[model samples]
Structure formats: structure tokens, C-alpha cells
Target: MALDLEGYLIDVERARGLEDIQTLILHLRDQYGVDHIVYHWVSSDGEQYGCGTYSPEWAQRYVDKDYLRVDPVVIGCFQRFHPVDWRKLDWSSKAARAFQAEARDYGVGRQGFSIPVRGPNGQFALLTVSHDCDDEAWDAFTLAHQRELILIAHYFNLKALELEHARAPEPIKSLSPREVDTLTFLAMGYSRGQVADMLSISEHTLRAYIESARFKLNAANTTHAITRAITEGLIVVGGTSRAADGGWPGRRTPS
Candidate 1:
């Protein structure tokens, strides 16, 4: 039987390192009655890393042959944010077909599902479950556990992020009231001129505040700035504080 996801989330949170997470996925795979569970992440620095239940030989072979370039799952999942069923992806290319053959030859499962996850600073990861079952059986399994699988995927990502930061600790930077205001409005889809009007600042000044926030967040661009801000809780846009400084990470005086 699989571990209870409610209790499992606490285990995920208390996971002290990557190894603990790896063990958890093994337990989760048993819980879901799937053959394998995998988590793969790509960092902003272009570093690729993750853990999974795939056999050691196959995992190494995938890396040694650079299968990532030809793997349909990696290619298709990268383009979307939602959970994907393997049957729906395109596998028409010669290279893709050959890779699929090799994967199956290596004992990879015949049925698969993947969830794409995105996080701060251009980080991306995938949580996948695969098994060797008939189409109808796979469909029933996915339909039954879809919501819990999604929740597990996110919590796993969060713990992974926390562990990474613990190893390479970066101090959380604070944003100013005006900078928070600029990002909040921008995240709401406001144009620069519109944000300027709302903040009672000139477009020139608006640009400065955005640049400052971008620098503080170490974001690559304005869109990245807004994404990073929201992820880090420096500015909460969609939730409570739909408009202004109420969502800023900390209290700040008027600038």
C-alpha cells in the first residue's frame, strides 16, 4: 500500500537532504502503485539535477547517450505547464521513435504522466509517474490520483528548493514600498504608463523602481522580476492585496 499523502507531506517537509527525498519518491511510487516516480530540475545556472526510481543502469545510459535531446517527454513537457499524458504527445519523428524504443528496451514503463513545475529564478522541474499497464488501467489510475499527485509534485519541488538554498544560502532581499507597488501593478498586467498613473509617479521614475526591484530579485527581465517577486512573497498579486503595498514582504514607509 502507498503512504498517506497527508502524512507524507510532513515527511517531505522534514526531508533533510536529496537522499531523503529520493526515498520518499520510492514510497510514493508504491503508494500510487506505479512502476517509477521521477523528479528532474533545471536551475537558472543551467545545472541539471534530480532523483528518481529508474534503474541505475538506465538512468546512467540516458545521461551518457544524451537522450534528453531526443526524449519526447522532456521536449513536450517543456512547452506546457499542465499535467501531460504520454499518449497525447507527438512521437512522429525518427529520432523520437528510436529513443522511445531504446527507453522501452531499457525497461522503462509503457504508460506515463508528467507534471511541469516552475519556480523562482527561472527554475523548472518535472514530476513524472510511469507504469506498464493497459491504456484503460492507466487512465483509471491517473483519474483516481490526479489531484494528490499534483499536490505531491509541488511539495516535492518546494522541499528540493529549500534544500538547495540551505546548501548555497542566499539572504532574502527586501523590496521598498514603491518597488513593491511597481511590481504588484505590473504583475496585474498593467503597462508602464498605467503603473505610473496608479503609483502617482512619472514613467521615468517607474522604470527606475522596476530596475531596482529586478536588481534586488536578481531577475533577468521585467517579467522575471514580477514572477520572482510573486514567488518569493515580496508582492502578492492574485490573492489578498490585489492592488498595492499590503502584499510587500515587510512593512515600509512611503517613499
Candidate 2:
């Protein structure tokens, strides 16, 4: 099952545009026998884009009503680093309850599981699967499907990132040696002072290195810089044998 899902993910990765993504979402919905599947992303400049199995009417209504303001999925997912179940979100608000009803009316399932993905430069995206199954069935399905969902979420995010890169005003800059060293230390759970002492630099210097790395990586902050560096293979986790000596890890050869 995992191998087959991997093949599906490879196909999804090859999708080139919004139309291709919409097709893939529909295909996955059918393959998994789910009621709906969606991929929605908000870029750094507040531009929204996505493709999914939601009805056109619902999509239009969502936009017309500006449901983005009260949608629990958007709110809850933004605050989370992991998958969220729809039931766990605060749908108790009158507006949220009305939105949920409208969503159901438009064929969005009553039950949902969403994975929130955060990318560099404040890019936020979500991959969600929704269905009308009972709680026990939904729970089991999500457990069975969690790994595949995560892979798909990452694949979707990568494609979006690629598109964003293609349309970017400036090319992303590569991290420098000192900048890489700073982020690597932070990624490995090092304190700024600890990293500075180890590198024979002052804490202020260390902060400058980190901030430079963050800017080069187009990251929103230090943590985001570390994550982007690791994801882009600019740094490797546990690849540092000299971590004990307070020395930075050897840099990866450029691919």
C-alpha cells in the first residue's frame, strides 16, 4: 500500500499547474473513496490559490462570503503544526456553525482531517480529507491514511513552492558558510549563547549570522530558516560528528 501510494505521490509531484492539481485531487478522492480532498495555500503576500474536489458553487460562496475570516480550518490549521480533526476545532461560534452547515450543504463532509504545512516566507498550505463516515470509521481511516496524507501534503507544498519560485521577483539566495553554521546549531537544539561560545563568536555575532541565514533562505524567522535549510538539503540532521566539539557540521556538497 505504501509503495502504491508513493507512486501516486510521484505522479502528483509531476503536476504542473492548477488544472493538473485539481485532477490529482479528484483522482485521489476516488482512489481513497473519500467524499472530498482539498489542497489550499496562502502565499506570503496574502494571495490564495488551490485546487480540490469541492463544488464550484461552494468555492464561489466561500469566496463571496469571505468565509476565510471565520473558517475554523483556516484558523485552527494556522495555529497548528500537525494534523487537525474538524471536530476538535471550535465550530461553536454562530458564524462557524453556519459556515459548517453551508459547507455540508455543498457536499463537503461533516468529518475531516487536515494537515497544515508551513513553507518558507510565510507560505501556509493545507491538505484535507473529508467524509461522512461515523466517528469510529473516520478515526480508523485517518490512522490508516495519515502517512500517505503527510506525503501528499509535502508534495503539494513542493509544487506550490516551485510555482512561487518561478513567479518570484528575485531568486532565492544560497546560505553562506557562517550562516549555515549558525542555523545548523539552532536546528540541533542549540542555544544562541551555546552556539556562539562553541563557534568562538559573541552572541551578538551569532544573532547576525542567524538573521543573515534567515534572510538568504527567505525564511520568516530562525526556526523557519532551520526548517527550510534542512528541507532544501542545505544542512543535514545528525550529520555532525563535531557537534560535541562545538564545531559546525561539514557542509553538504552542492547538488
Candidate 3:
């Protein structure tokens, strides 16, 4: 049966705490007919947190076995800027294969899709849904639900960040204009050199600006910087171009 994902999202938005988030995940798992749904986050200080539908025994086993060391999902997703399918990640190592087998035994499922979300202040998160299915069936499922899943991933990440921000010790700073310019072009899939030329700046200067922005935003890379900028409203998507006014080309405000 098809899931009422929209209703679930509304419920998720009303969640008050981590326990509530976990309850929502359990609902999603059953609703989507997936083996598990997991959302894991890491903050700037290296603090980790998560909410998921995985069994307590499996969760404990994962920690006890130090599966993070060999888990391809964690490693692969860390390096990727886009969503990834489980089949695309390398499971070539014996340790990785063993870990996968153990996960399967614990009912974590053989098929999975993961979205990597990077937020301001060195926050990194992953939203994953896994199930047991044939390759063809899984392909169809992912294709059909890809857009919804991406939206859901961002929604979940945003909600988690909001909660974190509410508990933060200090107020977060807004991105500078130069930082927003760099991120805007990057999000539109522009090459660094192209972006530099569009902004009438040298590539070296552009690199400096990007690095500064990354540092200020506590982003791990350019992609993360852009994602954070877009998520935090530092750069507007499909808005008027500030770049056209000789400020910096391609920089638009959100409408």
C-alpha cells in the first residue's frame, strides 16, 4: 500500500524531542514497508545523535562491533555530495562484507538509499531508508520516490537543526555577501573557474573567498558550504541576480 507521507511529515514537524523523532521513524518504516529508516547527525563538536527504527539489539551490535570503521554507507556518504544508493557503495573489503551480512541478519535489509545533508557549523547528517527487495524492484521504487525522499531528507535535517539551534550556547552568525555569492554559483553546478570569471575575479581570489566561507560556516567542503547556504537562507534560489548589478554575477535573492 502507498504511504500517506504528507501526513507523516506534518506529524514529524510537531515532534518535540529525539524520542518523538524515533517514533516517527518507526511509523515511516511500517508505512513505507521498509526494513528501517535512520537519521544520524554529527555536530561541529563531534557529538553524535540519531533516531531510527533499527532494533536495539542491532544498534548495540553495530556499536560493539565498531561497524563504523567498515561501514561503506558512512564512509561513502561522507565523501559524496549527492544522494547514493547502497548498491553504488563499495563493499569490496572482507570486513565490509561481513558487516553487511551482520546487518542483514539483524534485519537491516539488503537494499538502501541514503541522502547526505550538510548544515551550517559543521553539522553533517544522513537520512536512509532500507528494505529487502530485488534490484529491479528497488530501482523502480527509488526512481518513483526519489524526489519525495529528497524533500523528506531535507525536512528532517532542517527540523533536527532547528532543535539543535534552540539548545546552542551562542547565537549563529549569518553568512557574508561574498560567501553567499560563491555558494550560489556552486549550487547552480558552475565550475570554480566559470564562477570566478562570472564574478570578474581571479581563480585564486575566488578560492580564497570560498575557503574563508567554508571556514566561517564550518563546512567540510565547497559542496557542504553551498548546501548550508541554501538551507540557511544565506543564498536565495531562483531569485534576482545581485551579480548582474556589477556586484557579482549570478548571485540571486530568493523571492
Candidate 4:
């Protein structure tokens, strides 16, 4: 079935609170014919929040069992800057295998796609969709909706950040010209040395500017910083970078 993506986005923007977001996720799960759709976030100060279509029993079981310690999806996705398929994550360890089995028994699907999201002020989140389906069907579904899902992931994070702002607003910091230039070049497929040379700065100076920008953006890494900068319209990429090597150069694709 074709999802009314435009309508869903409108509904998301109109969402007033976490309850609205949860309702939207439930709607998405049903509309996409998926077992579950989840949005989970952790703030820099260690606060956690989530909205999803998963059963309460299963959600409780996960916490009770401390399943995250052995959940390969969570661990793998945390280290990645792109979307991922569950099959690509390692589940070879006995503990991981046991956790997988437990999750399956709790109605978690065999197939899943997850997008990692990073927001300002050190927020980390994951937007995931899971379903019970054969490999071929799952592959087709993901291929057909990959771009939509990516857009939704970013939108979901944006909405969450908006909610945070309402709770306690913070002033945004503008990046220095050098920092902006460095990130723009990095996003455009230029090496660090290349960006430094183009900006007529030493590599050491460039690194300093980049690190400062990363701090201002509250990004976990250089790639994360570049992505946040681009998403926030702080910089524009003229070319693609090594960090975005696969299909779309500067855009991250599912692996």
C-alpha cells in the first residue's frame, strides 16, 4: 500500500505533544502494514523518551531483561552515521542470539530498518520500522521507501528538538566563517588537507576550526557535524565527500 507521506508529514508538524507523536507512529505502523514503528531518544543528560507501536509488555520485558546490553542493532547503529538493515548487524554472539530470540518471542519482527539521528545539544535518537516478512519482500519494501523513511527520520528528530525548545529554549550559535568553509568543503567531498589548502589555512588551524564547530553543533564526530550543518542549512555542499562514498556521495545510504 502507498503511504500518504505528505499527509503524515503535515500531521507530524501539527503534533502538539509526545502523545500526538505516539499516535502518529501508531498510524504509520498500520498504514505501512508494519509490525512496529518506533522513535526513541536519549538526551545528553541521560534522560530517555520513546514513542512507538510496540506492545507495552514487550517494552517492559526489554528493560527488565536488560536486552540492550546484547542488542547488536543498538550497538551497531550507535557507531554508524547512516541507515542500517538488521541483517547487516552482527548477531553471532551467544548473548546476542539469545536476545534476538527473546525479542522474536516478544513479537519483534525478523526484519528491520533503522535510521540514526543526531540533534543539537548531544541528542541521539533512532527511528526504526520492523516487520515480519521474507527477505525478498523486506528488501523490496525497504528499497521502495528508503528515501521516505530517511526524510521521516529527520523530521521526527526535528519535531523532538522543537518540543525540547518549548521546554527550555536555548540560543543557537552561529559558526565562524572558517568553520563554515571547512564543513562546506568536507561535505563537498574534499579531504581535510584539501579544505585547509583551499581556505589558505594550515591543517592544524583547520582542525581547530572543525573541532570548534563540532562543539558548537554538539556533534559526536566530523561526519555528524557535517550532516547537522547541512541539515540546519548552515552550509551548502558543492561536491560529495568520502564520508558519503556510496550511492549519493554526500547523502548517507542504507548499507
lDDT of each: 0.85, 0.84, 0.80, 0.84
- Per-residue lDDT of 1-255 in model 1, one digit per residue for the tens? 655778999999999999999999988887777888999886655467789998898889888887777888888887788999999999999998898888788777899999888888767888999999999999999898888888988999999899888888685588887898889889888899998999898999999999999999999999999898777777777753434455354544223
Model 3 per-residue lDDT tens digits across residues 1-255 = 776778878877887888888888887777777788999886555456788988889878877776666889988987786989999999999999989998999988989999988877667889999999999999998898887778788888888987887777353356667667877888888899999998899999999989988887788998888776666557655652354332223533443
Residue-wise C-alpha lDDT for candidate 2, range 78-152, written one tens digit per residue: 978799999999999999999999899998988999999998877799999999989999999999989889988
1 against 4, candidate with superior lDDT: 1
RMSD vs true structure, all candidates: 12.4, 13.3, 14.8, 15.6
Candidate 1 worst ten-residue window by lDDT: 246-255
Clashes of each: 1, 0, 2, 3
How many clashing residue pairs are found in candidate 2? 0
Question: Which digits, one per residue and each the tens of the lDDT, describe model 4 over residues 1-255?
Answer: 778889889999988899999999988888888899999886655456788988899888877776666678878887786989999999999999988898888788999999988787567888999999999999998998889998898888899889978987554467876787889888888899898899899999999999999999989999999998877556756643323433443444333
Candidate 2 has an lDDT of 0.84
User: Candidate 1 at 22: error in angstroms?
Assistant: 1.0
In model 4, what is the error at residue 247, expressed in angstroms? 60
Query: Of the pair 2 and 3, which is ahead by TM-score?
Result: 2
| Clashing residue pairs for model 4 | 188-239, 189-240, 189-241
| TM-score of candidate 2 versus the correct structure, residues matched by position | 0.65
List the pairs of residues colliding in candidate 1.
2-31
What TM-score goes with each of the models? 0.66, 0.65, 0.63, 0.64
Which model scores highest in lDDT?
1
User: Cα deviation in Å at residue 18, candidate 4?
Assistant: 1.1
